[model samples]
Target: MNILTFDVEDWFHLLDHKSTKSEKVWLNYESRIHSNMERIYKILDNTNQKATFFCLGWVAKTYPEIIRKIIDKGHEIGSHSHLHQLVYEQTPEIFKKDLECSIKTIEDICGQKVIYYRAPGFSITKKNIWAFEIMHELGIKIDCSIFPSKRSHGGFPSFKNQEPVIVSYNGITLKELPINYYTILNKPIIYSGGGYFRLFPYYLINKWSKNSKYVMTYFHPRDFDKNQPIISDLSLARKFKSYVGLSGAATKLETWLNNDQFLDVSTADQKINWNEVPVVKL
Candidate 1:
């Protein structure tokens, strides 16, 4: 199943960067989430598709209308943390506090219990596998934080299964929809979302989608906002990774939405026979 999900943060929410690190400096950048999210809504409306959105508490708190519109449009919402901090960088106590704040923020806005989560930049690697237990304790029932391959900020390469699996960690089990990859030249290459999705061509993406049985996609508001200003402090490599293929990404996403039947996380969960899936003991 090809599942559609969006990391509902603004362009400046780029993790690990000093300028966009905290809410104090976040205001320095232009607030483009409103317009960018409009693009997403238009595309989804045209395609008549549903998606799961992992949103920042700051966003929901700052822009309650966005959260309300999401619910009104019949989309599922999940927590993407409060301040957009990396899970591994913060202490477990701090992480729990931030997670609780985020969950409470969104829950307060929509009056819906928050049970789904995704760390900023998928920052729940082996070093911070404790995050799973913490998330479980915080009432997160489904997690999409596993990258399944090497990533700059966060990835759980040691977690082998690419598809949906019962993630067993620290005596706690949770449903995991890890990012799946396409094998190219004996290497696991991800082309389903973010920089990878923008870098790869549609032909290869189509081929890869046809080849794989389960696909989980993670997109951001910035992916569709091509006119966003550049954060000059970023390194040359990060600059390129962040802005490359912006011009055509929206069209590509539109094409993908029109081509394939993508389901939201909740729907995908109901369709899966969890008992039959592989259990990855972390």
Candidate 2:
């Protein structure tokens, strides 16, 4: 099954960057969320697609209309966090507080409980496995934050399952849906989202998507915004990774959706049988 999802954040919500790091700095950028989101909504509409939108609490608070629109359009909603930050970098207390704030903020806007979460940058590494307990404590039923391979910001490379699995940690269990990876020369390579999605040509992505049995996709508004302002301080490699192939991203994705059948996270959840899926202990 190919499940569609989006990280509901502004173009400026880049992770680990000094200038794009926090709430205060966010105020300094141009608010391009509305325009970017319109493009996404239009794509979904045109393709007759339903997707889960993992949103930031700040986005919910700053523009409640976006939350309302997502619900009104019949899409699933999840938390991306209160402020976009790498989860492994945060203390358990900080992560919990931020998560609580996100749940509260998003719930306040849409009047529905937020039970799904995707951490910024898929930042829940082995070092921060305790994050699962906190998410379970706060009522997140399904987590989409495990990359299951090595990543620059953070990734639970030790995580053994890329498909839907029951993740248990310290006596707490939560349903985890991690991104599927392509094996290249004995290494797990991720090509489903962010820079990887943009980096590879659509024909190759389509080929990979066809080869994989289960696919979970993660996209951001900035991925298609070719006109987005570049962060001048970013290193040369980071800049290339962040901004590569923007001009064709939206069109490529539209073509992708046109080619395949996809469903939202909630629907994907319903399709899974917890009775027989693998259980991973973190």
Best by lDDT: 1
Off by over 4 Å in 2: none
Clashing pairs in 1: none
How would you encode candidate 1's per-residue C-alpha lDDT over 155-223 as one tens digit per residue? 988888899999898799999999999888989999999988899999999899989999999999899
Candidate 1 Cα outliers beyond 4 Å, as residue runs: none
True-vs-predicted CA distance for residue 195, candidate 2, Å: 0.8
TM-score per prediction, in order, is: 0.98, 0.98
**What is the alpha-carbon lDDT for the whole of candidate 2?**
0.91
lDDT of 1: 0.92
Model 1 root-mean-square deviation: 0.8
